[model samples]
Target: MTTIDVKSRFEAKLLRPAKPGNDTSWAFVVLPRDASEQLPRRGRTTVEGTINGHHFQATLEPDGQLSHWLQVSGELLEAAGTAVGGMVTLELAPVKKEPEPDIPPDFQEALAATPEARKVWNTTTTIARVDWIHWITSAKQLKTRAKRIVDACDMLASGKKQVCCFDQSGYYSKAFRAPEAESF
Candidate 1:
């Protein structure tokens, strides 16, 4: 891990997203194990920094292999003057403040429909909300996601403050991993 309190700088080769038919601009990179260890936590972490000298903020996802991965967006790619297959230098640190998550419409609507759950969700801290979202989106199957939504609502309504027994790191659960890179 990079030295504490000092920004971590490293070079990473960009790669294609795991799925086919993705937009050309959608790419990703896996942070080296050592760099990932510099983070404050093993779970999903929000980071603010620059890629190729262009300012950007994004959340890094746990690779489930005890590493971290980042999805590169089009705007970020353009601003940084890089693309898939490009090796770019990055300087990163955990964002001091958590940014609002882009919640899925389905989850949003579910929260809206359940007054009790909405009450709990609204009162929960943003970090907790992030965890709730991570749990929902981590589902590999649509049916599992749907069930998680229902369960989330139920748990919240019952006054559960966090997702119980969830392996946010994906390390112990083996339920998540960095998506497979597409064939070059």
Candidate 2:
């Protein structure tokens, strides 16, 4: 697989595509020279426009092409008497990366809190941590992340690493108690 890295906060000229917003307009997307495939997955990358002050969502595909979707409306096109596919520069600004959460503190705290959690956290490999981080951070809502964290913690305590333990009944415990553990 061929890979081209686009730096975050860099600009590129539209060559093949004649106008901005053209289906082919992405051919000229100027990535923030520092952009990276390693960038944390977020909803959409956006940047301010020099022409209209509109906030446009920009995306960099794996192939190094750029795509932009209109966020405001038809006002800009009408103002310029240009078509939707008219050439325009889509500026891609670097998104502020969030600081990495300290791992040892979280691991230590979970270990101190529950033995099962400690085992799970300890048994988890580096890849698992990366997956969990990406999953949690990608969530747009705080509540969703919190819920996922709770569930992840519960799973950890139950001696399961993600899908390996999620049963059909959604119950983690194998040792079922009579009335308390029964699910109807």
Candidate 3:
């Protein structure tokens, strides 16, 4: 596919979770696999796009099955004059420079306790930190998450710049996935 094809500009219908939880306010859409395959990577790729002419930026999370999904905030939906179940056009491309990923409190605390790791972390690229955060946070179990934090600290202290053996796309390990939304 051409670069333009990989950019994945297309239309999709907005959807909400069948049963709302803490995220009742958010709507979402899934990208077709073909469109997703055109992106730079399978993991979380930050993109700047317009939703029905309402400009916004977001990081597309891998859908565990080799595709990707995007969450549309209520504010964005309102700005775009779109709503859940509304069809919207999207024009997206990977951002030139990735913004820093939010560090979870537990991971931040762990880093604080390890001075060497904290120093290395401060020096790592924002994109690397993004992947590290994704790898650490994608763990399904609390114990797995805790272990990853400890391991991440050790690796960072040892001067590792990026996560090792992590499947960012979730296709190989099925470690990542799009959030569940209500089906039509």
Candidate 4:
């Protein structure tokens, strides 16, 4: 297993959301693997390879952490390495994320109390609610996290769950609407 020891800290920014239609839009600073080399490339062609079994395409940023796209078909096996005169296969390992907790009863009650909130909540998908709930609960502070929950609930009431403004082409487009609300 090849291990990459990065001594320096790096920051990666999302230049553009990765989507279909666009060939490439992401960018990152490219720094040297060795700290001895001071000269750094502001922008470099992203290295395309596999790590831990997942396919990754990342550009080197001025800082150390490589900004790359992680596409996983199966479990990631190993990290990238400098090899020559042989077949080089990227390895990928499983990325484990903490399981989401059940939705709070008070939160559900609040939504149930408000007509608009209920409408929005009814419109939002289970997956979208799960994502929102996970994001809100993940906050470090309870107050701030509660605020996020309120804010998300407001958005749902406003009818913008998983708000998709445009298609892959950056053009405003239509998508299938969520199922109709049930009637008593």
Q: Write the per-residue lDDT of candidate 2 for residues 80-127, one digit (tens) a residue.
A: 344433455433343343333345454345457777776787677544
Best by TM-score: 3
Q: After superposition, how far is residue 75 of candidate 3 from its true place, in Å?
A: 1.2
RMSD of each: 3.4, 16.1, 3.6, 18.0
TM-score between model 1 and native: 0.88
Cα lDDT for residue 75, model 1?
84
- Estimate, for each residue in 7-116, the C-alpha lDDT of model 1 and write its tens digit: 68899998887573647668888999988998877788998878887778789999998889998988888889988899999888988888878889999999999999
Clashing pairs in 3: none
Cα TM-score per model:
0.88, 0.33, 0.89, 0.34
Ranking of all candidate structures by their TM-score, best first: 3, 1, 4, 2
Clashes of 3: 0
Number of backbone collisions per candidate, in order?
Answer: 0, 17, 0, 25
**All models: lDDT?**
0.87, 0.40, 0.87, 0.39
Worst lDDT run of 10 residues, candidate 1, spans: 1-10
| Runs off by more than 4 Å, candidate 4 | 1-101, 163-184
* Predicted structure 4: lDDT: 0.39
Candidate 4 per-residue lDDT, tens place, 15-122, comes to 222331343322212222342132122112223334323345443222223221222221221232221121333332221222233677757766776678778766
